[model samples]
Target: MGAPLSAWPWENLGIFKYMLYGPFVGRVMYEIFYEEEKDWKFSWCLQLLILSAVRGLVYLFWNCYTNSLFLTRNRQILKQGVDFKQIDKEWDWDNFLILQTIFASMAYYMFPFLQNLPTWNSKGVIAALIFHVGISEPLYYWVHKKFHGDYLFTNYHSLHHSSPVPQSLTAGHGTVLEHMFLSLVIGIPILGASLMGYGSISMIYGYILIFDFLRSLGHCNVEFIPHNLFETFPFMRYIMYTPTYHTLHHTEKDCNFCLFMPLFDALGNTLSSKSWELHKSYSAGNDSRVPEFVFLAHIVDITSAMHGQCCLRTFASLPFRTRFFLIPFFPFAVIGVSAMWLWSKTFLFSFYYLRDRLHQTWVVPRCGFMYFLPFATEGINKHIEQAILTADKIGVKVISLAALNKNESLNGGGKLFVDKHPNLRVRVVHGNTLTAAVILDEIPKDATEVFLTGATSKLGRAIALYLCQKKVKVLMLTLSTERFEKVQKEAPLEYQSYLVQVTKYQAAQHCKTWIVGKWITPREQNWAPRGTHFHQFVVPPIFAFRRDCTYGDLAAMRLPKDVEGLGCCEYTMDRGVVHACHAGGIVHMLEGWTHHEVGAIDVDRIDVVWKAAMKHDLRPLSSGSTIKAN
Candidate 1:
């Protein structure tokens, strides 16, 4: 809810709200291509749009930079993470820029003195500064203070205050009326300069760009401003507000109301006593909390690399997919790959809190295709090893290897690390034990026999052994007779007959339960009976080719209800849900387990880990499939 007229008309338009500039842009295009002599106003309008885009890039740069845990961990002012609400509220953050451009264009025609001008104006810069210091500062200060009062706070100002942990875009997130007033505040300097015959295009560009830069700096939530500078010149603190100063205003709500200067707050007696103190503490590198658990994941593909939390928030929040809008960003993805390969180290991807425990996802900086390259194995292993060593150095209790990070062929399900560092205090976990558990538990109790693919793989072997013990027949699909016979010999002598070896997909035609651990094509999928349910542990899950047969999502579990600040999804999983391996690592952390759960799946610990996961409130998916199959 907001005050009357506070909301923009296109608030519900999403990305299409930018269409408001279409008419102006179309006119500009007409002037460039169709007209012999361009109207100065059209050129100015085009410049304003271009400047707005540049400022937009400025904001995006800060947002991505501040979101990186590797870069801004110690300088982060707020420990609480941003949620979807903040992301939604700031979606139309550039609305004010568009409004100002439109209003400025209208004013160009309305005022006779504001016609064409030169590119640069030195005198105009001085006049703009005077107008800003003498007028805009005082005007914004008083108006901002007034907005904090009861009625205004509820209807209008509360929208800006809604985000306690501000980002670069938070500077522009407010009601339309607030933005209108801001336009006036911004306009006074330029309008005053124009009246005095000192206005020029450069004056407008410099002043507005500086204004946006300061606003972004204050709200970026990273305290990069050094305290020593304020110590050297104490007066500078009154002239400029740091990220910490603005953070105080958001958190405390009654003080530090000035736009980009604290001098007004000092004069008005609203300056918080703790503002400078908190800033000093943050800038001095005080907030350095170590994560309790880490999930060491690697990039899946080039397309999936674009789904990084810091790269594209909206895309990362949903299931991973090939999107039309992502086409323009393909070059960026390629650059990211090249940059990572050149730099080549583990980096923080995302993080959240669960029951006061911090859990972070760290990427191994290699894509799935790169992992398959024979020459890339050593580099991948080195990155993974460095991450493990770093976690151990930082006192992280548990670190889980995810997806390809724990591939049997690559590192023997993370066994290589555990063996290399025998003195390691940090537990190395593959999390496949719980993955096997989740897949087995998803099968209906009435299921008597199951057809298995990738039957010789790590998870496949565990599932087959477990099911055979329960007298459930397992049709192991593998071409290697030696591997099949070895697995059969491991099963109890009495239950050995339950583990049957069938080398082809056609053998599973009579079976209704098909457990897939390998990617199957649509041609191979046709072998499943109409009612067959494909419970899978395959990466890039098998396609749902049959309308009559249901397909379960890759083994996953819903996070506990008490988990905090989980604003993004994990790969293709739904909100607040994670792959079973991720949950398994979390379970390991929560249970205070000390064993390194790597190498091979311990059949005895599968039920133990599953029970512990359930005890800690992690749950198996109720439906399995995102969409139903009849």
Candidate 2:
């Protein structure tokens, strides 16, 4: 059986018609207005000069923003070895700086003679601008292949190609020869159109500079295109020239010739089918396929710095926005200032409440954390020892079984004392069978504090579940906002609400959280079975007893330290969960946690707090342990 005929072929055929017929139609109109100007020398020069200078400025500023994002997100923000060192070196032989100046200056000198031409009418003027963008870009595209030929690429184009990760600055990166050749691409058609009376000097050259910014933007390394902008429309999606389109050009060196649209490349069939596929998938390039950058948890730190700066200014006798003109911008100003308030309310409270009891600056590492094994680091050997030491003032003696060597540091250590305090011996147990037998042998018959810690991994989650199965009031601590959200949605109503109220202070700092119990309400059965992504959730109560829950959530000592808050209740967002709307949400449960069949919370629905509360019909989870604060 043969493959079905493809629609892409038909689509290419239509583009071919547009490309071939477009310039011919343009040239026909040019012949109608052909006229000789008495003096053309100075005007042509002046127009070209202004065009280049203005475009260069726009390109420079845009490049700055795009470059900063690429470098910062990639952790190249601080600059690295050999490649970075080479950046400061000047290789201005390829500098387009002189070329832009030369062109803009020449245009200024030539405008007088070029401007008074009889063909400089508004219609012809617009056509001249149209012709500059319309033809020069296609010409560059059609000829870029030959430019990348062995001879030209090695000396002329290779300099620009050096920025495989091209920034906006890289847009103008070409050898002196390439810079010279670029002018011809615009000038030849432009001058010919002028000789044929197409349009005037001013509009034609002005459009050329605009094309510069377009190409510069097209070459930006960052993926700034909002997917929603183009995806909803069928025709526009394919037509838009994405950063991917230009990036693919740098990679293969064969397909990037056309820049304006697929009009040239699609019709010519020179565009990479692979590029198109990636564009459709929205991956852009493999380099851009990075883990998410979490600005939510980070916002608190940035805001703190900004607020401090503002306060300092005020203390020094300067108001933030005292000028009259700044009044109208107050709404935007308020939003800018309110970043702290928004983060604290929305993410701070929820996420920190889920991550930990300490308000620390938490960083979510890229790549899965599954590969890390439990081990020693930074003076903490047995995790239980550390927990014991932390609670030692109260006469607690803890032992850890983490020495069995299956778990990693943070993952193991956090789990051993999660929501629990140490008073007895803890032994490290590895392998599923060994851990089960050990648990069967010695259960904490009179454990005073029962809590769960560790990652949502097979080993860690299992340990927590085992504690939960013993009817131990487990303290569940999730690392990512995504995990916290999943657990909250999956847990029974009481557990869910208790998590919120208990962790509010912790959630306030880092947008990550740590809640300390699992009491399956009827609400859990309803929400959990529906699959744990999102559901209508009520805000958990603020007080978990007579104590302010925020104060209690922060009372834990060993949590990661926050950028601000000086070691108070802190949390860190798992960068992995920045945009649930965009990111893949597969939950990574602790290795041992899933296997035990500890049973899930039972709930079919939750209409209100009282309905779920009535279903709970038991003392609040924290009521048993919480003593009235002094």
User: How many collisions per candidate?
Assistant: 0, 72
Q: Output the number of the lDDT-best candidate.
A: 1
Q: State every prediction's TM-score relative to the real structure.
A: 0.96, 0.38
Q: 389-423 in candidate 2: lDDT tens per residue? A: 43334231221122122233443423444335333
lDDT of 1 by residue, 1-630 (tens): 546967887878888888988987887888888887766453866886888888787787777777777678778888767766667667678887778778888888888777776777799999999999999999999999889999888888898998868988888888888888999999999999989989998888889889888889999899999999999999999999999999999999999999998999999999999988888899998766999999998888888888876787656777787899899989999998788878877888788889999889899889898778889899899999999999999899999999999888899999999999999989999899999988888877767899999998999999999999887999999999999998899888999999999988999999999999989999999998898889999887888889999988888999988887676788888888999999999999999999999987998788899889888999888634321111
Q: Mind sharing the TM-score for model 2?
A: 0.38
lDDT of 2: 0.37
**Which lDDT value does model 1 have at 89?**
64
User: What lDDT would each prediction earn against the true structure?
Assistant: 0.87, 0.37
Best by TM-score: 1
Please give the lDDT score at residue 168 for candidate 1: 88
